[model samples]
Target chain A: QKEVEQDPGPLSVPEGAIVSLNCTYSNSAFQYFMWYRQYSRKGPELLMYTYSSGNKEDGRFTAQVDKSSKYISLFIRDSQPSDSATYLCAMSGVGTNAGKSTFGDGTTLTVKP
Target chain B: DVKVTQSSRYLVKRTGEKVFLECVQDMDHENMFWYRQDPGLGLRLIYFSYDVKMKEKGDIPEGYSVSREKKERFSLILESASTNQTSMYLCASSYGGYEQFFGPGTRLTVL
Candidate 1:
């Protein structure tokens, strides 16, 4: 089984809509979960970061992790046109050499204006 | 903000030719990594370095090699590039615990 799995969604939403993206992992050893946003022809940038489980919020974005269910989620409030991009879920265990991260395929999101 | 710059934004090479991809970071990070992104495969790590002159192979390192001669620069070398080696390559760097910062990927096509 893949360590992490996410919906490869070409999810579309209105400009002012709230967007929800999710990821599930099979490995319980994963302690770090991160969300990255990638624009076309650009690099991935960190959006939300959380260690272990629970939730972390930053501005209009909120990231939630449920270790018991091995699931994680990212919610975007009042999504804007600038938020259109591919959202990737990545995770790794906490320890030395934790630089190696396992990535999900990414969900392509488009917010219409 | 930390900046990770890749040498090339795009490259086209003939099969069997030697290819070199370079990455540099201005953040003075202790770890650097090379990963490839395919259509459906997402990103798979090829190699990484934790400290200067110290390297380790990642999940997919069959047709690639890496060099970390300096703390700020890491190089990925394809000694004999093949068509299958064509893909979007990403370079990233980070401290031990935080999320990594990725470079603008290099899209390579080996014909």
Candidate 2:
């Protein structure tokens, strides 16, 4: 099984809708979970990062990790058209390995007007 | 602000040709990484350097090499470019944390 698994979603939603993106992993050793936003033909920009199992909020985005179930999620509140992009889930082990991450296939989100 | 810059935004090369992708970060980050992004495959690390003159192979390092002569610069070399090597190449740098700043990717197409 892949170390990280995320649905390749071209999820379409109206503006102001709440968006929830999720990813699951098979490696319990992964301690750092991150979410990245990538526009078409562009490199990924880090959105939120959480260590172990907990929640971190940054403005309109929230990241959660559940080590017990190896699940991670990114929640976007009051989604806007500018939020239309690919969301990538990433994780890494502790210490040195924390700099090197295993990334998911990414989910595409399009917020419409 | 942290800034990462790539040598090219797009490149086209012939099979068997040697190709070089360059990256530079102004943050003086301790870690620099090279990754290729492909549809469905996501981002796969090719190589990384923690300091100048030091390099480490990543998950997919075959047919590829890296050079880190300076702390701010990292280069990925394709010994012989192949069709399969045509993908979006991304460079990132971090100061020992999960927050990695990325450059605008270089889309390489090997014919």
Candidate 3:
């Protein structure tokens, strides 16, 4: 089984709606969680980052990590057309080699205006 | 701001050709990584370097090799390009945490 699992969603929603993207992992050793946003024909960019099990908020995005359940989520409030992109979740274990992360398949979101 | 730049934004190569994809970062980051993005497969790490002259294989390192002769530059080499190697290749650099800065990907088409 893949260490990280995410729903490959081409989810479409109207503008101003709330969007939630999630991912699950089987590796309990994972301690650092991250969310990345990628546009068409572009490389993924770091959106939000959190360590261990907790929640971090940045602008209109919120990232939540539950270590016990091995689940992580990104919530977007008031979604806009500009927010239409693929969201990927990644995690890495604690140690010297923690820079290497396992990534999810990614969920593609389209917010229509 | 940290910036990562790739040698090419798009490349087309024939099978059996020796292919080289280069990446350079402005930030003096210690960690550099190479990854390939494919449909439904997400980003798969090909190789990574922790320091100059050091290299490590990632999960899917077959058919690929990496060179890190300099701290700011990393290169990925495909000994013999194959049709199956066609995909979007991405390069990233990090200072030592989960946050990674990525460059514009290089879309490679191997025919």
Candidate 4:
């Protein structure tokens, strides 16, 4: 099995709808969780970052991590067309492997007006 | 704001040609990484350097090598480009390894 698993959904939603993107991992050592947004033909930019199992909120986005189930999620409130992008979840462990991150297959999202 | 700049936005080369993808960062980050992004495979790490003159192989390092001669620059080299090597290459840098800033990416096609 892949270390990280995410549904590569070309999920379409209307503007102002709430969107949730999630990822699951089998590794238990992951302590740092991150969400990245990638536009077409562009590199991914960091959207949200959280340490350990908790929730972090930034503007209209919220990132949640559940270590017990090895699951992480990014929720978008009042989604806009500008929010249309591919969302990737990345995680890394502490110590020796801290510098390297394992990424999940991204979920593509399109918020239409 | 941290800026990561790649040498190319698009490149096409015939098979067996040597390819070089350059990445430069202005943040003076200690960690730099090279990753390839494909349709299904999100981003696979090719190589990474924690410091100048030091490099480490990532999950997919075969047929590729990396050079980090300066603190702000890292290069990924394909000894003999293969069709399988055609993909979107991305470069990233981080100060403490938690949050990363990425470049625009280089789309390379090996025929």
Candidate 5:
């Protein structure tokens, strides 16, 4: 099985709606989880980052991690048209392995007006 | 602000030709990485460097190599490029954490 799994969603939603993107991993050694946003033809940029399990909120984005279930999620509040982009979930283990991150296929989101 | 710049935005190369994709980060980050992004494959790491002249192979390193002659610059080299090497190449840099700043990405097409 793949170390990490995420649905490649071309999910469409209206503006001002709440969006939830999620990913699951098979590796229990993963300790750090991250979310990245990528626009078309551009590189992925860090959106949210969390270490271990719990929740982290920044601006309109919230990242949650549950190590027990090896599941991670990113929620976008008050989604806007500008928020339309591909969201990628990435995770890594501790120590030297921290530099090595495994990424999901990414979920594409489109927030329309 | 952290800035990562790639040498090219788009490139078209012939098969069997050597290809060089360069990346430079102004943040002087301790770690730099090279990854290829495909339609369904997501982002797969090709290589990474922790310090100057220090390099490590990532998940997908075959048919690719890397160089870190300076602290700010990391390069990805494709020896005898093939059609399979056609993909968007992304460069990222970080300071020993999960936060990595990515470059604009180079879309390479091997014909």
Candidate 6:
């Protein structure tokens, strides 16, 4: 099985809808979880990051990790057209050097007017 | 603000041509990485460097090589560009944490 798994979603939501993005992993060594937002042809911007589970919130976005189940989530509240983009989840072990990051095949989001 | 800058926002090159994609980070990050974003492939790492003159191969390092002569600069070289190698190239820097700052990306097209 691939180390990380995420549904490639072209999820469409109306304005003000709350969007949820998720990823599951099989690697027990993973300790760092991150969500990155990519606009069209631009590179990804780090949105939220968390270590050792629980949840972290920043503005309209919230990131959650469940180490027990190896599941991670990103929640976007009050979605807007500006939120239309691809969201990628990446993870790695805590002490490993920055090497190959297991990345989810991003979920595409399109917020409608 | 910490910035990761890629040399080109877009480029078009013929197949078999040599290409150089440059990346420079303002922050003195210990780790630098190169990844390519494709529609279904997501972001696949091309190469990475932990320190100056130190490098490692990522998942997809077949046709790509990297250089880190200076602490602030990381360069990805496509010795002979191929049409199949065309994609959005991204440069990222991190300080051994979950948070990574990324360059704007270079979109390359091989004709």
Give the number of the best model, judged by TM-score.
3
The sequence of per-residue lDDT tens digits that candidate 2 reaches over residues B4-100 is 9999998999999999999999988989999998887889999998889999998999999999999999999999999999999999998988788
lDDT of 5 at A92: 85
Better of 3 and 5 by lDDT: 3
- TM-scores of chain B, in order: 0.98, 0.98, 0.99, 0.98, 0.99, 0.99
The reply for model 2, stretches above 4 Å from the true place, is none
lDDT of 4 by residue, B22-111 (tens): 999998899999999988877999999999999999989999999999999999999999999999999999886778889999999999
B1-111, model 3: which lDDT tens digit per residue? 999999999999999999999999999999999999999898999999999999999989999999999999999999999999999999999988888899999999999
Which residue pairs show collisions in model 2?
Answer: none
Docking tier of model 3: it is high
lDDT of candidate 6 over A9-31, digit per residue (tens): 88999999999999999999888
lDDT of 1 by residue, B1-111 (tens): 999999999999999999999999999999999999998888899999999999999999998999999999999999999999999999999987768999999999999
Error of 5 at A17 (Å): 2.0
User: Per-residue lDDT tens digits of candidate 5, residues A4-67?
Assistant: 9998788999999999999999988888899999999888888889999999999999999998
CA lDDT, every model vs. true structure: 0.94, 0.92, 0.94, 0.93, 0.93, 0.91
- Candidate 2's DockQ is 0.78
Q: What is the lDDT of candidate 3?
A: 0.94
Give the higher-DockQ candidate: 1 or 3: 3
Model 2 Cα lDDT, one tens digit per residue, A16-97: 9999999999998888899999998888998888989999999999999999888999999999999999999998887876
Which pairs of residues have clashing backbones in candidate 6? Answer: none
lDDT tens digits, residue span B35-64, model 6: 998888888888999999999998889999
**CAPRI-style grade of the A/B interface in model 2:** medium
Badly placed stretches (over 4 Å) of model 5 are none
Task: Kindly indicate the candidate among 1 and 6 with the higher TM-score.
Answer: 1
* Model 4: how far residue B111 lies from native, Å: 1.5
Q: Could you give me the TM-score of model 3 versus the true structure? A: 0.98
Worst 10 residues of 2 chain B by lDDT: B93-102
Minimum summed lDDT over a 10-residue window in model 3 chain B is located at B94-103
